[model samples]
Target chain A: MKSILIAMLVAMTLPFGLATPACAGSGDVVVENAWSRASIGTSRPGAAYMDIRNAGDEDVTLTGLRTDLAGMPEFHLTSTNNQGVSSMSPVGEIAIAPGETVALAPGGMHAMLMQLRRPMEEGGTFPLTLLFSDGGEVTVEVPIRGIAARGPDD
Target chain B: MRRRSVLGYGAAAFGVIGMTLFAGWWRVDGPGAPQAVGARPLPLTEMEFSLTNHEDRTVGPETLIGSPTIAFFGFTYCPDVCPTTLADISDWLDALEGDAEKLNVVFITVDPERDTVEAMAEYVDYFHPAIRGWTGTERQIARAVEGFRATYEKVPTESGGYTMNHTASVFLFDAQGRFVSTIDYHEPREFAVPKIRRAMNDEEAEGA
Candidate 1:
């Protein structure tokens, strides 16, 4: 019986030791509905939005992001005064609590992509890497929708 | 007792500042100068101004007044707001059925520096063929915005280029060139469609 218990413990610990970084597919931190709009005549600058959810028991901080789609990928926020004047600014870091969802939406929080290598053509797809402060890196495929799409669901 | 007096003065000062900020906010939101909805007609001043259209022809209130006009002030470079609003307008017009013909939709560019007539033409064409676009010199654009009582300012970015900070509301005008109502930016289609129908119907009533 003592040997059997030891074997069971070894089996439980083996999965953890061999586990890989949560790649947004393992569901530790999941990114859903990642989407950006199509470019018009010029590629210029573009914006993307998505929902980042933390399903694990521990909190996670989004420390970095990368994409070949743009020269610069920045987390940004759009703020409007009561007078309807709108402004955009870069956000330093975004933290997601355990079991909570953070939405990056238009007219609010978004990912600003600058100096695109090519136009984000409609119906195209691109890859994004989201790095967590806990050293977990997730690669997600983002879809390119219409120029006036409100979101991926649209 | 001295500490209590200081606290009292601080509270009073804070209240004064709060009220001033609230007033400013109200002014910007209530562009037509706050009036009870559906109770009284807006005392709209004459909607008169001249700007070059996409075709490089001069147009003004005289040309747009014959039909109900839906005008939005935005730039072509706007990634989200402008295109989203234009799409919403297109959908609203579609929901209008045949009544869409009685309405003329216009987009006036606030960033006159980059939004030339040629650019405006291409931009509007991508949205809807019926939607005309307008752009002009800085002075002309400024005068047009002033006439509409709208506001816009240029904000410089780190890259040395600039973005426009402007009113996001869509202004509705009756066929007689009277101010009807302002549609809040990104208002749901159900809410906006009705307001537009009412604006168009009101024109028919006046004409009859």
Candidate 2:
């Protein structure tokens, strides 16, 4: 009965077009808008964007990502300098403070899905596991949007 | 009366010299000039480059000029900014109504080793139908970037694969090959469309 109630609470918290993977069951980290753009071709890498929130009293660190979608999945930050030149660099672990939400969106930090296994098509979905520093992981189904998708809601 | 005729002849000679100098200046930088008609020559437009378009045609600065053009530097492997900007460009063209056809939109690849003409063709197909893809040799791409004041650097990722860091801004040029302003990355559509229109108006604004 308690498990069923927790399921109900999870369903109530997540709305249509928003994805939150088992925060109630796994831990206090809630992920929403897990999505990626449709790749142009199989040779090119892809990227995923999402929002990870830490609802627990303690800080949570995102250590890594694992998925079958790409051979190498890493964290990348795309920064623009003052002269309007832009560049991307591999980022280290991301720490989410208590009640803080970390966003991986376009024009900023994102989950770099490198060396894609295949071309990610629009309307398709893939599973991704987010590894946390506490040895806990949450797997979310990432939906593929158009090549120009801004977010899950877009 | 003889002195009066001499003074008249001297005045006519001075007028002829002044006219010749004025005509030279006008032909060089005036409204009737054949190139960059009414405005200063845009350095980017003058920058020479020989590249192959997606359709396998030899294209240089002249092809891109003679019409309002927007050239964006990016690679097909780019997942976020390039696609987003292309989609934004498509939206701006849509907002342009029929006038969008009057403008030339080119997507130039900074990483030509991977982004071949075939790759560029398939890549630009995702966005507006009018977006033309251009790719060339590394030296050609370097030559092209020099004119726009654009820069690109290849950085190897930990995975041994490489990615490029390039200028994220879109360059805008008038029909006469005069440099206008640039549309920054992620510029709002409301602001972007107006800038495109401003470029479109350049020809008539200067009576060129």
**Top candidate by lDDT:** 2
TM-score, one value per model: 0.79, 0.81
Please give the range of 10 consecutive residues that has the lowest summed lDDT in model 1 chain B: B35-44
The prediction achieving the highest TM-score against the true structure is: 2
Pairs of colliding residues, candidate 2: none
Indicate the residue-level lDDT of B193 in model 1.
Answer: 90
* lDDT minimum window of 10 residues, candidate 1 chain A: A18-27
Residue B82, model 1: Cα distance from true site in angstroms: 1.3
lDDT tens digits, residue span B1-208, model 1: 9999999999999999998878887775656356332232232335456788998999876777778878878998877678778888887887887888789888999998899898888778767566899988888788777666677889887766677888777888888878888787888899999889878888899999
Clashing pairs in 1: none
Scored by Cα lDDT, where does model 2 land? 0.82
Share of the reference A-B contacts seen in candidate 1: 0.40
Give the least accurate 10-residue stretch of model 2 chain A, judged by summed lDDT. Answer: A17-26
Judge candidate 1 at residue B192 and give its lDDT: 94
TM-score of 1: 0.79
Q: What is the C-alpha lDDT of each candidate?
A: 0.76, 0.82
For candidate 2, what is the TM-score?
A: 0.81
Q: What is the TM-score of chain B in candidate 1?
A: 0.78
